[model samples]
Target: MDVKEGDVLNYDIVVVGGGPAGSTAARFAAKEGADVLVLEKRQEIGSPVRCAEGVSLSWLEELEIDNIDSSTSRTMKGAILYSPAGNKLKITERLAGDEVGVVLERDRFDKDMARLAVKEGADFMVKTSAVGLIKEDGVVKGVEARYLGKKFEVRADLVIGADGFESQVGRWAGIYDSLKPKDIMTCFQYRLTGVNMDPDFTHFYMGSSAPGGYVWAFPKDENTANVGLGLQFSRLKGEKTPKDYLDEFIENHDDYKDGEAVDMVAGAVAVTHPPEKAIAPGIILVGDASRVVDSMTGGGIVNSLKQGKIAGEFAAEAVREGKFDEEFLQKYEKRWRDELENKLWRNYMAKETAMQLDDITFDKIIDALSNIELETVTIGAILEGVKKKYPELVEEFQNMI
Candidate 1:
């Protein structure tokens, strides 16, 4: 539906898609005094969350962003790593980053952020889907969308697209929206309600069993955890899906065979770093919408919060200064990319090399790693071991190294 002139829907910064990225962006923008509005494509804002629910508290602090709520967390003590041969090694949550992250009730957490955003004076339209951008003089000037089948247009001085992976905003803004099949990770998780877990450390199982990917059991409520699996699409070429792998995993494992099944969640994540360009003439993209997820660990909440805040702050500041071009918006890219992109670059490189290892090689590598202290087990550490022990293998990734 075309938007008529003088439409009532308008905003200083219209934020499309109110997930963590959108909410945080809206909250910060409104907190900074922008007339912000967030449109979520669902009825219940955070319901049916499609995330792994793990986030680094340490990283959270660095962003200095508030959790949408305090009531919806399942604090975990740490994480565990399992080799292809079924050998398990655990690191206290403290070890990963020292008091690092927590498993959140994602739905509640989302609503909380929405509450904060609303309290700060941001409007919300649930069941809204952004369809296209309205351009003027070759610049993004507004968004046209559908809310409960009713067409509406929102004009904004700045439009922040936090719509996550599969975002039309990026395509509308002229970004190449295609993520290489290898660049994305397909994930499947189940919120098992009657299962027994370590109750402390998250468990990650790796090797050919989950080629190009791994399996995880992240702590949630007692007797509950987000048990899931993720694998590169290439891995799925001749194998079962992540969900199927997860089922086989649980069924074969003696301790998990009888666990009652409850909620199941599934989604795809951009395991790549943020795209080369995240902002355009009159808009900026954040969170999964910009592929801000970490390729190394598949973690994104902290990164999303950080990116969203920057987009929010810049949007408001840009509005105030009347600058909305690439020159002004590029700050969003430089800030996030400079601080975090290089790490992702390294991760992407390491991931490609790591996935090629067979179970025996995985065992050898892990056994070698066992000799090194966890504190020193950086990507460089692993690469060095591969170089010293498997010189030929390192040769394959020498360019990346």
Candidate 2:
């Protein structure tokens, strides 16, 4: 149904933001027979792409997204981690944190998700922005929005806030969505051609240069790739921007310097604690809206997709049972946390520990890991190796793994 000004358009579930999480939630909710609607503020569902687009194959299989091959740009075998001193530590495809998989055309991937939702009977309105929460007697019941240039209202039994990292919906619903400077990664990336590099493995460089985070080179093809860097906000000194560090990194690396820059992208990743409360009466937050991105890796696609699936199904159940209170919406939070919260929290702690280490400690840690020979790299294996060589460095991380 087309929205009109002054109309309180109704849906069983209204999802704000048509990104992966929102679309996935909408799709699943619709599959469960709920009247679902998705509102995307952007004129296009996935324009102005802002991701490196590397995703693990295992999770895609779990999600049963069979058409991923069509959108994949390159197949990655593993990642090569480079320390500040240029020491290389390779985590093979068998490693737990390897992230061996495909680099997607992110815009295509997001559009595909929206298509899935529409196919599942969810109505999506691009150019529709949720400006505020529709609260009925202190309970979130829908959203006050602007479609194109017209003001409108969307009323629903439940509201799923899958908005992006800078989510206003979650804040409007009174969810604690704040992040400290130390917990935010200011990132910048560029697409480059005329690059000479291995097409199989994604590359990561870590140390003070990208303080509290890392620089990445995710390949799109033999001649093209998304080269990027992320630095914790607290680590930034003077007027130095993420771009300044990235430029320095490119200048230092032969491969990056040789490449011709084509396009650039920038964004911030919340590498912080996930909100303890991601639910309110008739409202649920998923994806970055709930800060599900990993603090250590800055990876969120798999986690976001997982949360979206759970949120969608749970939203449907809530609508079915006519239970749109905080008590009922709390299940979505529990299910997603049960699946990912431990890893997310542990990784956040690990990132904090890593941020405190100097370049020499980072070099030692990389050297220690390189000494270990294993078929598959697990957190336990890596930590045990580090403990054997540098027991002092592993002390803070002992409880985390």
TM-scores for the candidates: 0.91, 0.96
Runs in model 2 deviating more than 4 A are 95-99
Instruction: Give residue 122's lDDT in candidate 2 (0 to 100).
Output: 98
Per-residue lDDT tens digits of candidate 1, residues 61-142? Answer: 5545554248446766777778877666666644566545678888888887788788888899888787888888888887
**lDDT per residue as tens, model 2, 1-401:** 46667878889999999999999999999999999999999989888888988888777666657758767888888888888898888876777453567898989889999998899899999989999887878877799989868899999978899998999878887788468889999999999887766778889888887888889999999878899989889988868899999998888888878888888999999999878899888889989898999887898888889989999999999989999888777787789989999888888887888888888988998888888775466666678888888998888888855
Highest-scoring model, lDDT: 2
Stretches > 4 Å off in candidate 1: 1-7, 65-72, 381-401
Residue-level lDDT for 188 in candidate 2: 96
- Judge candidate 2 against the unseen true structure and give its global Cα lDDT, from 0 to 1: 0.86
- In candidate 1, how many Å is residue 104 off? 0.7
